[model samples]
Target: MGRILLAVVALLLPAHAQEWRLTRSQSLTQEGTRAWRYTLSPADRAGRELWQKLVLQYQDHLRAGYRVDLGSWRLYFLGGRLRLEPHCPQVNPACFTFGALPVEKGVQDRFLLGLSQLLDQALAQARNTGGNLTLSGLFRVELKPGQAPPYLARPSGWAP
Candidate 1:
């Protein structure tokens, strides 16, 4: 296990340095307008090495509506995702969106909290590791920016 972990960590490091911040986060507005945003965070210390894992994220949401009358509102659904990361992989690369959240929504960012449930199908075991081409959460944005963020890990022996 240690050898595999060392090899993986070594593979993660490249000649160029990587940014360790989250950005391009978006949300909804009260007037029914779309609001896009982002956040950046970094830590500098030499305590627990694991505590210094760099994390970058991007999230976007769109919500548009017209209130011709209060009784009923008009909403046209048109929302997807666009992410770009020249420094790192689009996804966390090491993160596997499986298992369950260890903590509740502690921070204000709450858009992608429940989104994990949408990817629960990937949690099932198949005939082989690569038996099926599971999405494996490569397409799911499962957490929003907040004080209580989602776990960067999974339970002991879970594979997806």
Candidate 2:
């Protein structure tokens, strides 16, 4: 029986290994890679709830404005404000936002653009509701493995 129990535990180890965690934006303040990526796992109930609310709001925004779909997505919170890139970043015209662009376009340019806006709003609302440590808009950072990120600008408020 002990041998069987030990085997079962070993088999379950990998399944339990993937836990949710937030990679603090402050920790990745440095220069190195072109961009940094973070995760918003299911374990983060508050974050996930906020994300769901933002999704509904953003979908409405897109449908009312551009008439586009929000597609599948992943979330990350970095330290900075969103800004519109004057020039086209690549082939995707959707990548060029009227306000600010995201750090990485990933293939779904339009969806990401719309989602970022919603994320900004949700973070602000969350902060106001209580002292919740909610994640805000994602900022561009090039944190090297060992180096710290330099001083960066925070969003002036919310984009009008």
Candidate 3:
């Protein structure tokens, strides 16, 4: 029957092919450096793999657009045994090794572009998994030169 075939196909699909969400984020401006951290829910191997290749190989593309005033920055992510961290000496004092990608100054565009691609991958996975896409709401990041990024301490989402 048609329903039986559909059920069988669903059973063969991967879990990540169903949905992705932004589960957590950590932003820090420590020792004169800034870093924002976020993890995707339902992490997928394919998504991580794509980031490894695209981010690691983005140097040439990034060098073409590098600007000194933008300051140095790095974006990193783990892909299986491989880790991709874009280098930016002008901005980042030293790279952080934790499982995060730092976007140093001047590379905001690339960071956004990269995030969009990753999100697209998540969307596609949802389609493949026979699940509807769900978007995580926007989050605000408060930045200071030498302080931990502020977060909403109360339910109203106000920072004191």
Candidate RMSDs in order: 20.1, 17.6, 18.3
- Top TM-score: which candidate number? 3
TM-score of 3: 0.24
lDDT tens per residue, model 2, 1-160: 9677547644643433232233433233457432333322323464445444544443344334432222221222223322222232222234332222232333223334334334333333333332222223322222234432221222221231
Candidate 3, 77-115: lDDT as tens digits = 222111122244322212222113454432333333334
Q: Rank the candidates by TM-score, best first.
A: 3, 2, 1
Which regions of candidate 3 fall more than 4 Å away from where they truly are?
Answer: 1-21, 25-37, 40-42, 66-114, 117-160
Q: Point out where model 1 deviates above 4 Å.
A: 1-10, 14-19, 43-160
lDDT of 1 by residue, 63-152 (tens): 122111101111112222222111212222223222233333321111122112212212222111212211222222222223121212
Can you list the residue pairs that collide in candidate 3?
72-91, 73-104, 74-102, 76-101
Runs with alpha carbons beyond 4 Å of true place in candidate 2: 1-34, 38-43, 66-160
Which 10-residue window of candidate 2 scores lowest in summed lDDT?
A: 68-77
Error of 3 at 53 (Å): 0.4
lDDT, residue 136, model 3: 22
- Which candidate number maximizes lDDT? 2
Worst 10 residues of 3 by lDDT: 151-160
TM-score of every model versus the real structure: 0.17, 0.21, 0.24
For all candidates in order, the CA lDDT equals: 0.23, 0.33, 0.32
